[model samples]
Target: MINICFKQSSSKILGFNIEGHAEYGEEGEDIVCSAVSALSYTIVNGITEVLKISVEHIIKDGFLQLSLRDNNLEEIEKCQVLLETMLLGFKSMEIGYGDYIKVQVEEV
Candidate 1:
């Protein structure tokens, strides 16, 4: 039950939070965190040239927030696409693993 919340501020991408338990046990937890971290890294690396942004990973609450200073609508759109693509890839992997790991994406 990994929960992800995407927050939109003034139509320019604000940030997102990732939290919850993938399942019981340390291995499950680690896998969930690893997947999220990989996805976040991929997104940042993919759009680094297109948009200058800051990504914060809050360990205690399992939150990852990406904030963009530029308010360009095109940048926002690009970020959204990249983020979704990464998340979809994670979701596909989860399907094969079942409840061992999970990812939920929500727009806020």
Candidate 2:
């Protein structure tokens, strides 16, 4: 299952931790996983490449984690929209694949 967790600092969403994979089918043929991978990679690439924001991240087989390198709200504000939209996409995915994906919000 893919677990998407949004971290909150005070009332604002700081960043997120996305880990695991939704083993719904064979790796290459899983549409659910495809959608998620596309969206997740897009956001991560956008933030670090297009948006040129420094980020802390980790990646391994079946897992990926990402966070802003700096915690200052001002620094985060630079990519706030992208981060929130990423979570929104993840939540939408959960609506359809709740059995294989989990979405949660946590205070950090």
Candidate 3:
């Protein structure tokens, strides 16, 4: 199963951590994994490349983590929309692949 944890600070999202694989199909044919990867990468690119906001992130096999700490409130607020969109994508995936993906939100 894949685990997704979103870190929230005072009502705003600070970052997220996603780990593990869906294992829903053959390694290269897992649609669940592909969907999750697409959403994650898109959000990261949208924030860093498009929005030009610096963030802390780590990516590797079966794991991806991203966090925002030093950005000013304005930048953080701007990132909120993309983050929320990613969360929504995850939740939508969870609805369809409940046995493969799990999502949790934690206050920090």
Give RMSD to native, each candidate: 4.2, 1.5, 0.7
For 1-108, candidate 1 gives per-residue lDDT tens digits of 666656555543455566665663586457656776677666766777556644443445555556554446666676777766766776686777656555554445
Supply the global lDDT for candidate 2: 0.81
Measured by TM-score, the strongest candidate is 3
- The alpha-carbon root-mean-square deviation between model 2 and the true structure, to one decimal in Å, is 1.5
Name the top lDDT candidate: 3
Among all windows of ten consecutive residues in candidate 3, which has the lowest summed lDDT? 67-76
Colliding residue pairs in candidate 1: none
| Residue pairs whose backbone atoms clash in candidate 3 | none
TM-score of each: 0.57, 0.89, 0.97
Q: For model 1, state the Cα shift of residue 80 in Å.
A: 3.3
lDDT preference between candidates 1 and 2, better one:
2
How far in Å is the alpha carbon of 98 misplaced in model 1? 4.4
* Rank ordering of all candidates by lDDT, starting from the highest: 3, 2, 1
List pairs with backbone clashes in candidate 2.
Answer: none
- lDDT for each residue of candidate 3 in 1-108, tens digit (9 for 90 to 100): 999999999989999999999999999999999999999999999999999999999999999999987778999999999999999989999999999999999999
User: For residues 1-108, what per-residue lDDT tens digits would candidate 2 score against the true structure?
Assistant: 888888877667767777787889998998878888889789889888997877888777777788763656676887778878888888888898898889999988
